[model samples]
Target: MNWIWISGVAFLLSFLAAGVLIFFGKELEDLGITGNIYYIILIPLGFSSAAFLAGAMKSYASFTSNESVSYGKLQLTGPIVIFALVVGGGFIMPNFNRKEQFDVKMRIVSNDRPMTTLNEGTVTLYIGKEPKTVNIHDGEVAFYNIPEKYHNRKVRIVPAINSYQLADSNEVLISKNEDYVDIHVTRTKESLSTLVRGSVLDQKNMAVVHALLDFSSGLATCYTDPNGNFSLTVPLPPGEKAQLKVVTDGITRFNEVVTISSTIPIDLRIDKTP
Candidate 1:
């Protein structure tokens, strides 16, 4: 038997199998196979395949050669060498290509000024359902070990503070190499209150006097004045959607969702019940 040829063939087969395993490792993980268990099962299968091929080749060579072949103590040398190389490389190669991790720093600001009063709060960064939260320190917070894939992707940053309307900013773009981000927040007299001023009118466009307006499931409720004008502050920040229900004379007039963007007055028209 040609020992060199057997060794070379076994090495080639083992190398190709290892490459396939590495390529599909992520897919395997998604299929609920963890890395340790995955490699544990696949590596032995690869090694056995290589050893079988080497043994078959050795048998064929022995059958074809007319001369009497002598049995050697190192008969399984080819398969043994391949197993050693595969197992050793599996442990050694990861050190050369470590996954790159990043640290992201965020500075909180309100009205274009760094917030000095906000010394205690948590800032959460979300990429889909995965959230990384950090406590604010000196108006700044940091997230560490952010994966490289999140770079250049859009992420939502939300601040949790008391007696303040923390705006959710989804326009934050995670830069490829940049680590610092600036977030602007809004402060309100109450927790995330939006001043909504609007008018209630009938189908005839006449003022609907004494009509009751409920904002955000009664978070803020009030009645329209004689001029059909109403004003209330709802507990919601800008760009948030809230339900607004209007009632007059024991009849539901208007029930729908509205986006709170500004204090600009909106007109709500409904048909009067006979």
Candidate 2:
């Protein structure tokens, strides 16, 4: 459910409940005198009105902002409050500077397969001089866009990854295991330390970190080379996890499942196993 809609509904319900109690309950009338019914009704109405007005003011402030707000008194939260007020105050403020204030480029590439380089094609929109496009050797579209812009400025092509999705309204039920059991596997090598110095000292059997993926299941099989080496060039499989066994002769064994991602190197070593 949308939080904003939920909040609005909850506020409306509370206001209605307060109104009902004031009108039907004798306790409310007994607490006050005759002709004071107006006061009773006005109090709640004033609260509701103030709440709505504050929300409106906040919304209005959000749209308006000055490069500077000159206020004599500065409180600890004055800047934050001013920011909130400008954002919520329902005003549109323009940024005066236009000299490449901030920018970002999205580069997409198929590391496993061949595709066109992102730099090869004509950038459809306001691509910078050296815009970073997906570095592909084949035919995969790569694009980016400014998340927020002052005007309807069209620039980088927005890719599927940049789009947002709203989940369905139906209640979702999910079950997951809270506890996990470790399995045993073996590996030949391990890194000496998490912060590895320049190179392993005098080690020929040293293994460079490499990832093996089970194509059928799309799970990553990661193990560190007792050699302490890793490769960042490998491509990630489009799967939820990796499934593989780690074992090495004359070395420790670890048979456990670990989450997989291309962003982090697979550096599990049997020697480090406790």
Candidate 3:
């Protein structure tokens, strides 16, 4: 019996055992190794096991040829690290972290009515523990990449209200008695035009244009469409200065400020010109 043959068999068996333990050993109470520790130990066991198995194959191959078998740990390190990130543990961190977190509360009220729940709501933190309440529908809450310090904190949001009723119109009366921002989205206008006149040999320049009715409290986003064609009816927070942002085809086109009023119309034009 060749020692190399015996060693090969032993390594294979040990490797199989380690794999099974990793897959189904969650209840292995007495097996001092568990979780990451189990995997860490199995790492070295796996390498040694392979070395033994390869030693046998080499012993046979070497006698047939002058070539020598060579192995290195460097080859395994990259794969192990990648496996840990994608399979062993990193994937679960987001869900687990959310559950372990303490959340903040945001209160949102709208002018439409005292809705049991808001259509949207968000909190904006300028600094420290203090955060301002912005209506979710105003598009303020869509901001991502909140600093880590503000992560998991809750925001309070409220909508705007109208104070009086119109005499003879289908429009509902706005209740201004409550604290909220007044926001109404109406499609105002749309148009199309050319930025650059294409010659017989040039690419055609076409623009889809739109006009918008924008109103909010503090933030206002205003811009003509890139092609000067389209308009938007974006919700505004209740204040004098507000931020405005636009999205077309899942892309954020622009961000800026403007005074939001019932009188001014926001315009956007998306360029289709190549």
What is the C-alpha local distance difference test score of each model?
Answer: 0.69, 0.34, 0.37
Model 2: residues >4 Å from true position, as ranges?
1-226, 232-239, 250-252, 271-274
lDDT of 2 by residue, 1-274 (tens): 2434544554576567556676754443323332244334434343443444445433222333345764333433323454444343323232233222222332333323233333343222234464333432233332322233312343434222211111222111111221211111111122111211111112333453432322223332333445555332223332234343444443324455544444454444344233
Clashing pairs in 1: none
- Model 2: lowest-lDDT 10 consecutive positions: 178-187
Please rank every candidate by lDDT, starting with the best: 1, 3, 2
> Order of all candidates by TM-score, from best down to worst?
1, 2, 3
lDDT of 3 at 22: 69
Deviation from native of the Cα of residue 242 in model 3, angstroms: 34
lDDT of prediction 3:
0.37
Off-target runs (Cα >4 Å) in candidate 3 are: 1-82, 89-100, 109-113, 116-123, 126-274
Q: What lDDT tens digits, residue by residue, belong to model 1 across residues 1-274?
A: 4544554565576566567667875444333343455356446644654555566544322223333556532334554555666666665676488677566778887773457556898877885456767778888887765678888877787788654555555458777577578787777666466787888888889999999888777788999999999887777776678788888878888899888855567788999975
Best by TM-score: 1
Please tell me which model should have the higher lDDT, number 2 or number 3. 3
Model 3 TM-score is: 0.19
**Which is superior by TM-score, 2 or 3?**
2
lDDT of 3 by residue, 94-207 (tens): 456543222222233334345344444333434336433334443322222234453433333233323322122222222223233233322212211111111111123344
State the lDDT at 34 in candidate 3.
Answer: 40
